[model samples]
Target: LEWAGDEFPWVLEHHSNLEPETQTWHSKLVTENWDSPIIFTSMVQFLEVLFGGGSRGARRMHNIANSVLIFDEIQSLPVNCVHLFCNAIQFFVDHARSTTLLCTATQPLLDNLKFPDKGQLTLPDDRELVGNMTEVFEQFKRVEIKNLVRPKGWSEQKLIELMITQLKEKGNCLVIVNTKKWAKKLYDRCINSVDADSLFHLSTSLCPVHRKEVFNTVRQRLDDELPVLCISTQLIEAGVDVDFNSVIRFLAGLDSIAQAAGRCNRNGNLDMAQVYVVNPQDEAIDMLPDIKEGREKALRIFSEKDETELLDPEVMSLYFSYYFYERANLMSYPLTEKQAGRKDSLLSLLSDNHLNIGIEKNAIKLQQSFKTAGKAFKAIDSPTQAVIVPYGDKGKEIIAGLCADFEPAKAFKLLKEAQKYSVNVFPNVWRKLIDAEAVKPVQKGEGIYFLEERFYSENFGLSTEVVSKMDTKIS
Candidate 1:
């Protein structure tokens, strides 16, 4: 639901009641009405209404007051805003008659969440919706998790060899890596080794539309029981519905590992699929603290238990408990102390009515920092700038549209279309692209950049070496 606005049209196309005449009405309702009987929205959208400043925000708050709120993939909640999120959930349930459902394969310890004033959150007695969860897990156990990590880690060559071996044995498989760089490298190598049509690459480096196209092709192959191999980053760990006979995952969080395993034998058509967890020697872990920390915790659990226990719900609970304990301080908004001069988190700012009294005198500036607070709340810590890529014919058309004129409505429509051809690059990469003259601003004064070169490929998506080549040419 995070990209609800972008996904609205795609979703509506499949709706049972969808009609050509009523499509515009449905679109308007979805875009304007937050309190629609069924609405899809991002967490940021929800938070803005609850804690946002201005009359507009206050007006939207009523929509959520008596509505049912469901948060899926609960473990993905940002650590820095967990307390704020929990408090909001509690506020809706207690004060507004709203019911809240937090769903996850590996549930976090919500009881451990400590707010500034409310203390720990309390969940209902029958919080575990499924009875005999252990039995359910046993019945649904469709994969055998195999630890392939060595102290020295597997080199790219060795990893490729392992994948080839798996492909020969299993016929179709999915290899999930930790980073886009590694995913691209592996895909480049494997594309050469296998039939180009049977191999697929997926990562955030490719826009959603491109990924969707790749997924469709892969699905068709899988449906026909043809050989297929997909190399992807952690983006495919959750939400993706495709199944593979085998899965190879670069070591990360236990919950993430579980999610990866889900892609294997997802429909239980296979007796028991195989999921291999490996640590790649070529991929650097220093830049990814979450992956590093998660690997440590998951490794500790792996040391104490059998590999098969990786998907056990009890094991998952233990993993999450340890994971949360290690980063307990970060569970609250980090900028609270810096901005408020006290250990007052966003929850404290929203819940404490006394703070609102000083708005006239500026005695407390909590209300003033609402926008800043929202800006600071990041689910993923790394800041990335989106760049428009020339992915295909449609991608080229979008880029052409973006460059042709500056009409607000048409530009807005083109920008939405451009999402399919967009890729998010780190600041360093953005700088490199700028230096290479491979990117130009979307408009005369706009900050958004568009790829100026044919640096994207159908198979690999974006070429990471484009900047270096551009630098060489300039030199």
Candidate 2:
């Protein structure tokens, strides 16, 4: 549903999960090559084409030249890939001639970003759209962020109770948790207090199509001023449109806190909205060091007794200064040398090999490790494989199509359609499902998988709980 009545020509730069050919000209693009005159794309897609070594993404790299690139939340840039991201951006601007724009309430100090290698986001003084950000930020004030994060973190019951309390003052409430497991746990508790119809659970466990369905229902319910409660992971923080009178966000980065505020009082019907920062006791972010560090910085801001607003531009600057200084060594995409048994990084391999360990005058091949760096690079730490879930009759039909005899054209169309019902599972979870025979590939060597119907939940969407419980039963 796009309306460009008298505006410029527009097309979304995306692969699967697109509309049919008849819907718009965007779908007719050949293999998502990103050749549109006016293109809208995700940050991940831009980064992939910028740094990724894949031929598919490289084919679209030239399209970014002489075009505009907007990074909605520039602060959300990965800590380790800071230098890689900046250096690539410099290349695009200086070499390819592209215009870059950043739109973030909590902009990170990219200029101060320094590593051993020379990859810094150095910008001129006249680059700022607004000279005085602190004053400008005050004008956009819509939500009051309240720091209620305790030392030991809020218990599951305490968070639910807080939501119940907010319901009295506000009609709709949103609880953003850190992990999907915690979201599901809190959602189960929320259903007991609110009606099952009004309670919604959102996470990566559900496919994009399923999430869209939930979004439509939630938005409609909010419009009617009906009592609505949604427990979601950080996925709903950005780019989601639905709003609530009160928002309870799990304590995270300052940028994340700013983003959560956008979901509250969005239309500004209320005088002022409130966003509560709550830390869950059961939350564990060991694999997520970036989030852990961001949470610690946010805790520092919480300890301040000043009357400054949560998204005060000055406060945001302090948070990033602390965060970047703490993670100074990781800005260069750190990696280890496989052969040299020494500390190295992906950026160094791609750059002018300053710490050359394996270079000899008579070397047969170059030790730049260009291919190694490309193969090693990953946008997301946890690489997930999409699994088709039985979300509805449409999902079932897509699964049937995937299992049918091989035909490239037909398979491509079916795969595109299946994107709606596909849930991306991490490697560990995928392995567990495979071990329990809860999932299997639809076509061998094709890499497309289908999950057993019992493993997919109407409430939880997808989980390994059924497989684990069945194993215990067998034992």
Backbone clash count for every predicted candidate, in the order shown? 0, 0
Best by TM-score: 2
Tens-place lDDT digits, model 2, residues 310-379: 6888788888888898889888778775532467887787876567655454254554766667777777
Best by lDDT: 2
> On residues 365-420, what C-alpha lDDT tens digit does candidate 1 reach at each position?
44444554544444455546678887667778887876785665566456645655
> Candidate 1, after superposition: displacement of residue 360 in Å?
14
Count of backbone collisions in candidate 2: 0
Q: Estimate each model's TM-score.
A: 0.79, 0.86
Candidate 1's TM-score reads 0.79
RMSD of 2: 6.2
Where in model 2 is the C-alpha error above 4 Å? 1-42, 52-54, 115-117, 124-132, 305-307, 337-341, 359-367, 465-475
Quote the lDDT for 76 in model 2.
Answer: 77
RMSD (Å) per prediction = 7.3, 6.2
| Model 2 poorest ten-residue lDDT run | 466-475
